[model samples]
Target chain A: EPEVTQTPSHQVTQMGQEVILRCVPISNHLYFYWYRQILGQKVEFLVSFYNNEISEKSEIFDDQFSVERPDGSNFTLKIRSTKLEDSAMYFCASRGDTEFFHFGNGTRLTVT
Target chain B: AQSVTQLDSHVSVSEGTPVLLRCNYSSSYSPSLFWYVQHPNKGLQLLLKYTSAATLVKGINGFEAEFKKSETSFHLTKPSAHMSDAAEYFCVVSGPTGFQKLVFGTGTRLLVSP
Candidate 1:
């Protein structure tokens, strides 16, 4: 089965550096989403994208964050300036016509 | 709006014993519910989902969940626990626009012992 894929399973960066997390959603899915789970906390939604634009975003997805399709197969999330609190397991998910979302293994971001 | 609550934060079971993880949900419209499992460092794997089909839904890995609208609950259960079942379980409800967004419960940590 085709699965959503995320790169750089682990990322380490300085507090003020910029970072871009990458994901390749299932080939035929129409919707893409980003979620993150801080250690010992519940998973929180960051943003949702469709038709090449952001449809909705949570408060956590401030101006520092942005998402782009870039191409037909890749979806990227960029954080302009990282903070120590940005450390978390970021997950990418996609869904087709069905009412189910498939998730990727996740990218563990660590900001020092 | 949609939300889910996992009644138990942690549940322990011995191999060969039955297992249960409770969940309750609140949704403005008819909801689509799902159960996901996560191993220590792995991604969330779909266990099963209740999409207004049969009230009882069976999923992969011999796991199952029942949706009771009157109770607003969707609880996960397994007849026999296995060591491999030791993981974190989350109960999720689809957002109003369907699967566009998922609201997840805090999660229940299942510990299976021999």
Candidate 2:
């Protein structure tokens, strides 16, 4: 089965540094999403993208966060400035005609 | 709008024993409920989902969930447990419409002991 793939399984960056997490969604998927899971916390939604524009975003997706579909296959989430609290597992997901989503393995971001 | 709640924070069961992970949901519409499992250092894997179809939904890896509308619950169960079954399970809910905007539960950590 085709699946979503993420690069840089683990990322370590100092506080105040910029970080970009990359994902290659399923080829045919039309919608994309970004979610994060803090250690010992629930998975939290950040943003959703369709047609190269953000559809919706949660409060957790603040000024420091941005998403881009730079190419037809690659979707990325960039954090302008990493904070200690930003340490979490970031998951990328894609959706097609159905509402079901295929999630990537996730990028573990450790902002120290 | 939709939300999910995983009742237990942790559940331990011996191998060859039955397993149960409780979950409850609240949705303005007929919610689409799902159970996802995450092993240590691994990504989330879909176990099963209920999209207003048969209440009893069977998923991969010997796992299953029953969506009880009356109880607003979709609890995951397995007849026999294996060491590989140790993982964190998340219950998720999404509104009937939209781009699969999901609300996830805090998750239940299942520990299978041999």
Candidate 3:
């Protein structure tokens, strides 16, 4: 079966540096989403995208965060400036509709 | 708005024993419910989903869930637990209305003991 794939399985960056996490969603999937999980915490939704625009976002998705589908297959999440709290497992998920969702292995972001 | 609550933060079961994870949901409209499992350092894997279909939905890994509208619950159950069943499970809900944004529960960690 086709699966969502993410690049840079793990990343380490300086506290004030910018970071980009990339994902290639399943082919033919229309909706894409980004979520994060702090160590030992529940996964929190960050944002959702459809038609190359953001559909909804959570409070955590502040000005520092932005998502782009620069190409047909790649969906990326960019953090303008990384904070210590931004260190977490960021996951990319895709779904054609409500019935099923496919998630990528996730990119572990570590900011020091 | 739609939300899901997983009753137990952790559950321990012996191998071959039955498994049950409880979940309750609050939704203003008919809801779409799903159960997902995540192993260490892995991504979320969809186990099953309920979308106004039959109340009893069967999913992968010998798992099943019953959607009880009267109780506003969608509980996951398995006839027997295996060692590989040890993982974190999340309960999620989505509103039937357009936008279909998913809201996830805190999660339930299952530990299958030998």
Candidate 4:
């Protein structure tokens, strides 16, 4: 079965550095999303994208954050300035006009 | 607004015993519920979903969940537990109110011991 794939299973960066997390959603899917789970905390929604634009975003997804399809199959999340609090497991998900969302294994981001 | 509550944060059962994970939901309209499991350092895997289908929904790994509108609950269960069943389970709800955005619960961690 085709599944969403994320790169850099783990990342380490210094505070104030820029980082871009990459994801390849399932082919033919129409919607994409970004969520994160802080260690020992509940998963929180970050942003949702459709039609090559952001459809909705949570307060956590501030100006420091942005998402882009960039290409037909690649979905990327960029954080302009990483903070210590940005450390978490970032997950990418996709769906096709359905409530069912397939999630990627996740990228563990650690900022010093 | 839509939300789900996982009653128990953790549950322990011996191998071959029964397993139960409780969940409660609140929604203004008809809601869709789902059960997702995540092993340590793994992604969330959908176990089953209740989209106003049969009241009792069976899923992979011999697991099932019941949607009870009267009780506003959708609890997951299995007759016998296997060591592999140990994982963190999340109850999620989505409604038209939020463009089908899923609201996840805190999650319940099940431990199956021998």
Model 1: chain B TM-score relative to the native chain B:
0.96
lDDT for model 2 comes to: 0.94
Candidate 3 docking classification: medium
Error in Å for residue A49 of model 3:
0.7
Tell me the interface RMSD of every candidate, in Å. Answer: 1.2, 0.7, 1.0, 1.0
Q: State the lDDT of candidate 2 residue by residue for A36-101, as single tens digits.
A: 999999999999999999999999999999999998999999999999999999999999979788
Candidate 4 per-residue lDDT over residues B3-53, each given as its tens digit: 999999999999999999999999999999999999999999999999997
Q: Model 2: number of clashes?
A: 0
Each candidate's fnat: 0.77, 0.87, 0.71, 0.48
What is residue A58's positional error in candidate 4, in angstroms? 0.8
Q: Estimate, for each residue in A4-105, the C-alpha lDDT of model 4 and write its tens digit.
A: 999989999999999999999999999899999998878888999989888889999999999999999999999999999999999999998788899999
Q: Tens digit of lDDT per residue, candidate 3, span A31-88?
A: 9999999999998999999998999999999999999999898999999999999999
Which prediction has the highest DockQ against the true structure?
2
**Pairs in steric clash, model 3:** none
TM-scores of chain A across the candidates, in order, are: 0.99, 0.99, 0.98, 0.99
